[model samples]
Target chain A: MDHRQEDQFEYQLKSALHRQEPPNGFTVRVLARLEPARPEPWPQPWLHLPSLRWALACALGIAVFAGGWMFQQERRRAEGEAARQQVMLALRITGAKMQLAEARVRHLSER
Target chain B: MKRTLLSVSIVVAAAICAPAQTIKVPESWDKLAAKADDVVNVSLDKKMLQFASKFMEEDENEKHLVSKLNGIYVHSLEFKNEGEFTESDVDPIRTQLQGPEWIHIVDVHNKTERENVVIYLKMVNNQSLGMAILVEEPKELTFVHLDGPISPGDLSDLSGSFGIPKNLHVSEKETSKPKAEIKK
Candidate 1:
């Protein structure tokens, strides 16, 4: 073939290889597969509500109050028990002393 | 009429004279005075040095007043307020108590009220034989001088005078009972 005809053929082959074009039915197939995504119903959104935070804080407060009240009651009970023990000890001592004194008095009377 | 009147007067005089027939006054003031001296001499202020002297003079019956219980020589106890007692007031007493026979027992503090309680006990042969004093200060102060034979077992009894009641069940019952009752 002549050089001019050969050059034209090479140019035509290069252009064909480099050219860009949309694939056949590419856009339509993607749109058909998507099916509108159904919007996902927005995920309930309760975690973001103000009432949930309020409920959590109130529960924590109530738990803390209950713990504090129980602690106070236990402390007071312990104190009362301690006081009772002290009183008991004192009384026992007094009784013993009185008995000793009585013995002495009796001994003296007999003498 | 005159004879009846004279008889009535004689009977009245005899009746009046009957009560005076057996009455007699005894001279016992000297004995009483001596006893008063004994009590005063053994008082807290003067007892320490005088104790040995007075104890020596006690009769057999009176000697038992100073009990030697559990190897302890317990003599007497005296209670007084702090205002009525000064450091100097107790100096002579304390000096005698601190003799070789006695040992320091306990000294405690009330941190909240800044008060103190001091106690001393006497020991012979490593056995508690006597008590010296118990001083408690809580705004007002109470000083107790317990001189007598004491034992470890007697400690509870000694502490009782300060309102520490023994027999918890009995005290509980007594305290729980109402002091007064009302009738509708």
Candidate 2:
């Protein structure tokens, strides 16, 4: 009813509304359950068998040698064919020119 | 003995007689080149000239006028000699015909006779405005220029008489703009 009593009542109501309950042993429960994680075991060393290494090396060598040989063979074959073609072409050209020259000469002689 | 000796001498003489002269065969292109100097210049080939003239004489109204189309010109050709014709032989004519007003679009090589066949097309926009071909054969030379809406496919059709090389490519214009014209 009085100003002081009304002020006290309002303060008490605000305090009651804002008050919070204490947590139920949450920190203790979490600490009790917690345990440090174990570090994973190191991976096993890669297999390095002598036979496997040798087999791999042999395969690579064989592949390289085969590729190189094939390339060389192809190049030589191409060159040989080109040379043969050139010779044939030249012979053909020369023969035609001679024939033409002969015709021209014959015509000139007749005139 | 004297008779036998005479017979032997005659046989030997006959055997020593020179073999008949073998006429060497020349290749088709080589035979063609040997007569190049006598071949008519590209400016004089009657058939090609007629075709070019016909193209130019088309009615202006009937002509397909694309903003990208340009002028057309043609040349008659004959080659009459066997020497290797260089790019220089064709350069003078190309220079005269090509300028700010004209563009160079194609250069094709005829391998059989080692001849350079040059084609110049006039350009407007990015399209072929006109077209021309300079075919230097072993025994003939022909130049053709066409002015109109010419397509690159039309050139493929025109190249039937002469063998077109597989490596033929259309030269690109220097400018990035579509309106840029290609120069020789």
Candidate 3:
């Protein structure tokens, strides 16, 4: 067929396929269909909550407190041990001097 | 006259009942320790003594005295040369100890060696309450005072680590890292 006749035929076919007036609620229906799925925001606001933050903070605080308590106990234990050693050493010397003094007294007595 | 005598007797009896005075160690002795080459200035009060008793092993002789000790004062000063300390330095301490509640237990004199050891005990009601030992050597001066109930027999038996003698050689001990060497 001729170019003019073909153009006229294509226009008539497009017009026949196109809607003259949209159906009732056609815009609303199309818009609703076009609307993306809400997907419930991935994580439910209840599932990943503020309470979880509080729980994490409490756990970290407990761990820190326990570590500090253990450190303090260890330091006190070390101090007590050092004091013990000093006392024992001092006592030993005292005993030795006592023995020497006694020996000297015996020597004098013998003389 | 009888009443006056009775009143005086009551007062004297009351004075004897009074608790013994705390031995006042001169601050000069403490200062001397600060100046010495090495000093063992341990003064454990009642609470500290109780704490120290926990570290001590279960020995009858040691426990007998260790449990009774209310205080421990040790001031030992070592010098680089002979005649570092004089009689005048220790005379004041000797004088203080000469007062009431004290008795000379033993005195050892070795003039040739320049080593003299004097031991004194504080007595109350025939029971020993405390002890003091003064060792005056040419090179060192040591003063050890243990306050509380003690027995001479028990003290003589006391030594280091059960039965180990504390006679560690001075030169070897000075080379040792941490152990205390009893310098005679």
Candidate 4:
């Protein structure tokens, strides 16, 4: 009984594990049964690409530097103009004082 | 590119139009004023001067003298005791201002009173461009630099509003005293 039962078990196992040719059109049938998988949207665009990331960072740096330089130049020009105007104004105020003084002297002479 | 270049050109043109000469005042004027017991520093640049003129009532007979002004910087530092600022401190300004661009119009020095008054006129092609007055006393140092075309008569017209008219109409008696004394 033990030898017969063991032989039967071995045969069943062999049969289960044995390689066999699939039926004709098996792949086609399986593929037809399978649903088409939906593609997920890209989480990150060009920034996720290692090559483009450095380019993006460099472009940003250049833009900020250029903006800062332009601003500095404009500020310098404005400051120079302001200083010049102030000088001229100082002279005018001086003129007014002198004129007032001369008028006083003239008025006295007339009296 | 064209627009940016155009804008830049406009800025350059503006810079050229008002080639502001460096108005000489002590760079330390603000600091000195801070150290004094009393300080009166009045700075009216071109824009401020223009804005101030708007408040003045329109006069058809007036020549709008204020429009001619570029700026007015007046700094008066009054100390508790004398010698808060040494003569060395002002000598640089005096020296720099002694060139042909300037003419010393009035020099009144009374050593007994320890007072000095000197007025400088900036002459360009026989026309006065501006004026600077440096007044020094034992306890006070006052400097006023007015830039632009200034006529005393034009100033007299605006005197009542500016507290300058009273100083302008000084009689012979007050004129005999130090003009600086009557100025305040």
Candidate 5:
């Protein structure tokens, strides 16, 4: 609140914020701390064999082809089954209507 | 000369590959369908019939019939109330069947009950080429068109092989409302 106290506060503030020499290897230590941790990659020695690479590729292709073929077969089967059901239903409905018509005709003939 | 030959071949191919007959439902029928509570519309082309034939293991007759069919179209609509559709709405299909190719087989109309059943057969050179059946009740309408060589005698086989369920009596069909299982 007084000039003396103000001067003392300014002096303390300057002392606390004044630049000072950093400890040895401060930059080196910070840089090392900032560096990210990385795990060693897994060994891929098989990847280097051309024949093995080709074989693996072929196996994948075969698997994909087989899966697609199986899916197509299943789709055809489902479609066939559905078509069969529709045919049967249509036939049944047609049959029922015809029967009714026949009975009516028979009744009329009797009359 | 090559172009002429190509055109001739194309025409021949079309004639050979085309179905015996086809049915066209009137556009107004679509309006009725919108008000229907349940509708059954099944259409199968030649390829589909062939595909279905493969699965008709239960019935040899079915397999034979399906293999010969070029197409089958069945449309049945059940309305929530009576008078959803009128006789005039069915006139277009009936008129179409009145052509020289189609012969009117059975026509039974009960004016009191407002029920009508009309059957037609498409004949080419005295051989039946197709069959069409139209059934109209107070609250329901059904039309079936089979495009292929199907004779009148075949009708009896159809009635017996896949006979109507015993519960689906003709008398009850007028009053009772039982949805066909396929409608589900």
Candidate 6:
């Protein structure tokens, strides 16, 4: 095409794509679209009460402590019983040997 | 400095003054244990006796005797064959009882049956400190040491209750028999 025709086409394109004012509330609409909607926090009404929270924590602590104490007590009792059996056996042996010694003396003296 | 010195002196004195109650078993005895068919070893110190006494509910006499004892040690070995151990194995135990404080209370040897039983009592100022019994049979050897203030009379009462031979129930009269040989 000739230079005159090219210049006419360029003027038409510029007028057609000229900058203009944005529609009203365009910024607010874009911001709202980009931003995330915040959800509500989990409902913990019991945790919000200080006394109930403290009570639950204390009960858990006490259960753990009492279980440990009972285990220790049972262990000690078992050990004590074993030791008792040994003591009895020792005494029984001593007594039996003493009896034999005494019997020997008695038998010899009768002769 | 003076307080520390006093404390040290008191501890040293207590250590020296404490009666030697526990009999030292010879390490050589371990060799016999390896050959034995059955072994019975019981070693209970003062703390163990105290702990065990709490559970001695079956018999009051046992509870009383156990409470008074500081320690009890027994080592018995049974052999499958005759003469698995010799007199030399027992000499170490006998030597320990030969200390000045220990008095040989009973020594009965049956030559015919090849059985020997010896009893020794540790006495200090007429107070019984402890007792030791050594019994040797054809296939078994038993050694018993009872620490604390216990006399033969205390053990005599224990018979017939704790699986001890019922015949061991010696009355005071029988225990005092002239032939029974009660050494003061």
Best by lDDT: 6
TM values, all candidates? 0.28, 0.29, 0.63, 0.48, 0.68, 0.70
TM-scores for chain A, candidates in order? 0.53, 0.48, 0.51, 0.44, 0.53, 0.53
**Each model's DockQ score:** 0.01, 0.00, 0.12, 0.06, 0.25, 0.30
- Clash counts for the predictions, in order: 18, 44, 0, 20, 0, 0
lDDT of 1 at B103: 58
For candidate 5, give the docking quality class from DockQ: acceptable
lDDT of 6 by residue, B1-184 (tens): 0000012222232245452447877876788888877777777777677778999887787888888888787777877899888888899888888777787667788987778988777777667788788999998888999989886677656667644555544343432332334321
TM-score of 1: 0.28
Instruction: Tell me how candidate 1 scores on lDDT.
Output: 0.39
Q: What is the lDDT of residue B100 in candidate 6?
A: 76
- lDDT score, candidate 2, position B59: 29
Question: At residue A108, what lDDT does model 2 achieve?
Answer: 40
Off by over 4 Å in 3: A1-47, A109-111, B1-21, B27-35, B57-64, B156-184
- Write the residue-wise lDDT of candidate 1 on A1-111 in tens digits: 899999999989999889686899988888887778656666457756889978978999999999999999887555444333322232333344334333333444466
Q: Which structure is stronger by lDDT: 2 or 6?
A: 6
Stretches of candidate 2 above 4 Å error? A1-111, B1-73, B83-89, B100-103, B109-112, B154-184
Ranking by TM-score: 6, 5, 3, 4, 2, 1
Error of 2 at A18 (Å): 99
Q: Give lDDT tens digits, candidate 2, residues A28-92.
A: 77777764554555542342677777787899999999999999988755544433332222222
- Score candidate 4 by TM-score against the native: 0.48
Candidate 6 lDDT over residue span A13-76, tens digit each: 9999999879999999888976776455565776889998899899999999999999999988
Go through the candidates in order and give each one's C-alpha lDDT.
0.39, 0.41, 0.64, 0.59, 0.72, 0.74
Sorted by DockQ (best first), the order is 6, 5, 3, 4, 1, 2
lDDT of 4 by residue, B1-184 (tens): 0000012322343345553534666677667766777665456656655644544445522226655677666666778798788887678678867777676655656565666667666666656677677878788777887788754445556555433443444232322232232221
True contacts kept of each: 0.03, 0.00, 0.31, 0.08, 0.67, 0.67
Give me the candidate number with maximum DockQ. Answer: 6
Chain B TM-score (each prediction, in order): 0.38, 0.41, 0.68, 0.70, 0.75, 0.77
Please give me the total number of clashing residue pairs in predicted model 5.
0
